[model samples]
Target: MIACGLLLLCFSRKQYVGKVLVALGFILLVISSYEGISGRILRSLESQYSPINLSQVMAPGGSATIQDSVKWIVVLTSGIAGDATLPYQLQVSHHSRVRLIEGIRLHRMLPGSKIILTGGTGFDGSPEATTMSRVAEELGVSRADMVLEVESRDTKDHPLY
Candidate 1:
């Protein structure tokens, strides 16, 4: 829409219509992408919850947290590049990297916990979970402590797999 408006404004005789379209398109784009607006909407729709404090939750011996039954930390992957030329760390999406890192952190703190990395061979033909696993290993997590769910296509499929 923005591109159409710009083209009409530059090359067509309907300059006034083009200007109106350009203004509307810009306004819509800004409104859709603005974090403050989205945050306000989310704040209205979601319930507030207490944030977790590791210091208070984890046992003093670094063995188990207060929730001794907790055994798995699931980390869902967003996506990854299929390009073989790129290193595993470079192929993982930034969001996936952050999530994997946090999962690894939790795994370390919880001792017996395993990190379940989830994703599938998406459009790029690269299993997102495999890429996450390689990066997790590079970050010092043992392969034995990580389970890769590499058949899920998206967030909805992650739990199913």
Candidate 2:
């Protein structure tokens, strides 16, 4: 749109306006692509989360122990691969896998807490929660300890369900 507008302005003999628009667009493009600026924005958002102390949660024997009031470890699905030929564990996306792993870690640290996995069938045609459940099961999380809220297609739907 900016390019088309600039071209139209140039053809209309408004060279000054066209040049200014082109310069402004170039500056915006450069600013948007700058890694340092984007990285700082991401870091600022991530900093809102409280830091986790794994040493306090994991016992000397490498088992997780609970001492918190958390009753539910909710894991929101990130994404999934649609390929049915692959194993269920391999079907989860990298981001989703990381989230599931963190959820599992927290679950292990909270004894008697239940895991609530939420996601519906996305564009890829598989329910993310189902795939996450399979991975959690493979990691030794009992079936009774997990709940599948599989009707949620997005975060907005999660709270409603």
TM-score per candidate, chains pooled:
0.74, 0.73
Q: Once model 2 is optimally superposed onto the true structure by TM-score, how far is the C-alpha of residue 14 displaced, in angstroms?
A: 6.5
Once all C-alphas are superposed, what RMSD does model 1 give against the true structure?
Answer: 4.8
lDDT against true structure, model 2: 0.84
Worst window of 10 by summed lDDT in candidate 2: 62-71
Candidate 2 residue-wise lDDT, 108-148, digit = tens: 77687899999998767768898889999999999999999
TM-score of 2: 0.73
Give one digit per residue, the lDDT tens place, for model 1 in 40-90: 878777647554467776767754556666688999997887787999998
**C-alpha local distance difference test of each model:** 0.85, 0.84
Error of 1 at 39 (Å): 4.4
Relative to the unseen true structure, what is the C-alpha lDDT of residue 90 in candidate 2, on a scale of 0 to 100? 84
